[model samples]
Target chain A: MTAATARRDFPRAYGKVGSLHRERLWALRLSYTSLIVAAIIFLAPPVYMLMTSLKTNAEMADQTLSPWLVRSPTLEHYGATLENPLFLGFFANSAIVTLLVVSITMVISVLAAFALSRMRFWGSQTLATGVFLTYLVPDTLLFIPLYQIVGGLGLLNSIWGLVLVYPTLTVPFCTWIMIGYFASIPKELDEAALIDGASWPQMLLKIFIPVALPGIIAATIFAFTVSWAAFVYPTAFITRPEEMPLTIGVVSQLVRGDTFAWGQIMAGALLAALPPVVVYVFLMDYYIAGLTAGATKG
Target chain B: MSEVNLRKVVKLFEGGVQAVRGIDLEIADHEFCVLVGPSGCGKSTTLRMIAGLEEVSEGEIWIGGTMVNDIPPKDRDIAMVFQNYALYPHMTVFENMAFGLKLRHFPKDEIKRRVDRAASILSIGELLDRKPKALSGGQRQRVAMGRAIVRDPKVFLFDEPLSNLDAKLRVQMRTEIKKVHQAVKTTTIYVTHDQVEAMTLADRVVVMNHGVIEQVGPPNELYHHPATIFVAGFIGSPAMNFIPARLVNAAGALTIQLGQGLSVPVPADRTARYAPHASKKLLFGIRPEHLTETTRTDKQNLAPITVDLDVIEPMGMETLVHFRIEGTPVCARVDPAAGAQAGAPMRLAAHMDQMHLIDADTGRVL
Candidate 1:
């Protein structure tokens, strides 16, 4: 307790505390820096799209104008894209296809996930693994056979073709996400529900669905985004302008052969990407939680 | 009519894991029966079978005199409270309690009344508006009980519902559950690994081990006259101490030879029962409370022994003196004022009448 010893020990203790604080500060700075760099890298393309979408056709054609900057920003491109009948038709097509596909995917995946996770039938585990493996099959590989199925059914130029094929892509992955989420729920919840006089279907609608809402939202987002942006099937099957989705229609109608209306194209692309971006911005927490819950809990 | 009877019920899970072997139990109406044992002892599995959560692999389960082997849980008229509470996180406390009634298509007013009654019974009326996530552990537990009580099912199944609470909360919840059961008077089957919970809650305790029922009796019956060695060891706190001993007939009196030059005379009633094992090795079982500091004058059936105390745990009211007899560690609960010290020789008296002589080979009480 002497002043001599106190003075000698004080700096050492203070030094230890000071270094700990500095280490934490350095870690915070490093993480923030990396996050900013990552944000810039990822946000670059969207930012460029937004800038280009605001440019006039003449400015876009000018070689001297910086692509990153719209010297005279105009809403004309957005107005043009929105006013185009073909664009409105394609937007309606995407909406119908995305809504139908998401609804079907949710219904099918929730039931499939419930059966795979809780109901102990034979081959349940193998079937669960098989569902995930089916998702791993590339869409490019299935598009050829799918082309025949669409052709055989004489639905080559129909929006229904997209609806049918999109589920094949969306169901497996959505079911896999849902299965992990459902499996993470305590068995006791369902057991208590069962003992409380809830039938299997009642349990799903009342207990499982509400409890696994985040996973359902994540799956719905995946389905909506996937169907909205789908290109390969819509391009291969639906050759008619009226039946083409927003993704394929934008490229096909906006850009004539050897003629790229770059400003309108960028505007349409930005507009098309808006739905998913808005959805993700509003529900980013649920999306990330549902996705990581499967990996961590499993 | 609400009685549940399981006849030779067997549960063999996939991959050949025998969770519950053939278990035959009959729980009478309005009886609070507890199934207790260590984890993986098939106690929970047995309760699940009765609740129709797990299928009976071999035999029939009769609920209210009806063979319900093929009946799903919903049709079986049982309500279960889980260890984790299992309150639906999405629903308000009132909604969670009313969900079962709604599914049954009960009248809206009736459902409201039942939920309100149950919530008031559990003293969670103020919590009716909150979701399960907004409730604390004890509140969630009460909500879970309220969910079950609202149904007013034929049987109540509790799967260690209070195990998640802290010690003081567990004790509080324990009494609350008992009081609820008394008021409701439903045929109940509770499962827990805590012997104290079983001893306190059950009208009858069914002790299970390794997928088999070891014994079924009242708590005092299991304590004072455990039918098996496992029951003796599992049913008491600071469990009963066991010593390897040999019974011998010396001058027409049967005495248990505990160790080198140490013999305690067997009681007259037990002498006849242990006569056949006179020359055989046995396990001498004695609860810590039965052994005390030896006084100047020893009462009848109180055998005196002297041993070097290895450790003395002074527990305010009584001292737990730990020592070894024939290299086997033994504990004796002596008076705190006995002046017992570690590594010092101390005289203690064992109540011979309370001693149990178990067959060492079979682990069965003689």
Candidate 2:
């Protein structure tokens, strides 16, 4: 009401606004800095791979050539990797194995998750936990037994060997993720469906499967990435290049006796990693949501 | 329409939790029966048993004269509306309403006709194309009801379907549900914790508590003549005020003695009812509305009492006056214009004929 007090209040109000502005600026600066740092950390390996894939073989061999710079950018390595019958075979094998494993994982995991979560059978909870615990078992520990089993089945040098072993790694974790997603769904939806004349399988197909698409996508991504990048089982089971998945095929066939075809290897690795990366880029929200939904709900 | 009969049905959940214990109820065809109780009182479990959702652990459930103990819910010919509405989030309202009919392989035109008819009945016709996420809570509830209505099943089950809406919307939906039920004339079993909803919607109210059915009668019957103390306490808002008293026969008169020289005469009609328990401790149950400011015209069944007021809550039309009668707190719903004040002595009268005397030890109404 007085001029003197009004002037004092004006500066106090300005100070409050100034402090809020500074706080907002600090938050923005901190987020931007951390984002850039994270981007560099995550992008560095892929960027290096792309650069290596573009380098000429001569430049890669030159000792003075900077590893990060492709002085002579060439599509020669991509062309070579694509044209090589061995690389093409490995790529085809990986694609088939990944597709089969993903489909099998989704079907088995969806049904298992539905039963374990919704059906109130004896020991269902214990069985669900057991599935998750099976996933927690390290793959290295099971490789020897798995090897004997695969050999005993007389599929030692077959792509089917990898398919059989891949599910062992994919199904348990995928089922666990699905169980969490299914459990997070309100129980009433399934009950309502049941009252609406849906049998158990019908309920899963009509309601649970459609409602839990994000979790399914997340599980699919996990299954595909794991099946595509599988190394231990393929290396242990298949010594033949024809049956080796892309991961083992590339590493075994390209680097012969310590003479590394660095450009072609990087090119093959980059190409192999493309599917999952593209999947993640497009479905990042669903991936994170599914993962966190599993953790929190479970 | 078909009758739903539960013959001593019991639900023993895992770890020996008995949710519904021996509930024997027969809902006649086209009767609107409501199972009302407090939380954990097995009302919802009873409805679920009739719907074939929860397995009847120890008894037989008969719907339309057929024992349904071994039948799955899908074959039971009943439709249920869940408290959460349970509208499929991914489906449009039309899809949700048509799901049951499609499952039964009804003709597409028939399914459409049923859905449109039910949607119009619930006044949710325009929302048929919208997904459940795009609708409000009340709209979703209407869609849930529509989903059930389109089935034209033998029985309809509602598991506290209106519990999730706001107060105003809940009342509005309550009336809409009543209207829908009246129009369809299907045997319906509704469950809710709110007694008001039960009283308003049910032709017969089954009051349950502690896994047991305490009383089953018309809504007014349950309110006016509750069989147990729990029913009396559970079926009213602001609840019935219970005062510790003793029925004493002294000098050829029947009266209930309050503490510290306070007594109210029992009505002559109830004199013989209280005569046998003359010396026993009892609970005197009086609803708040029965206690009011003493007026000159009040003569029959109005026993005047004076007490020091503790608090006053004016609820628009009526003011709730809190007071202590011989160290026991009691509330009287008085005229708001009576200008009752806190900490002031107020003259009030308890309606003697409406008072309930319960055996203190067994909690059964006398």
Per-candidate total of colliding backbone pairs: 0, 0
Relative to the true structure, candidate 1 reaches a TM of 0.94
lDDT of 1 by residue, A1-298 (tens): 5865665777767555456678888999999999999999999998998998898888888998788987999999899999999999999999999999999999999999999999998999999999999999999899999999989998899999888889999999999999999988988889878877778898999899988998899999999889988988998998899988889988889987889887788899899998989999999999999888877866
- Give the poorly placed runs of model 2, Cα more than 4 Å off: A1-21, A255-258, A296-298, B296-299
Off by over 4 Å in 1: A1-18, B296-299
Cα miss at B132, model 1 (Å)?
1.2
Tens digits of lDDT, candidate 1, B225-317: 999999999998789999999988888999889989988889988878899887666899999988889873367889989999999999998
- Error at B215, model 1, angstroms: 1.7
Per-model lDDT: 0.91, 0.90
Q: Compute each candidate's TM-score over C-alphas.
A: 0.94, 0.94
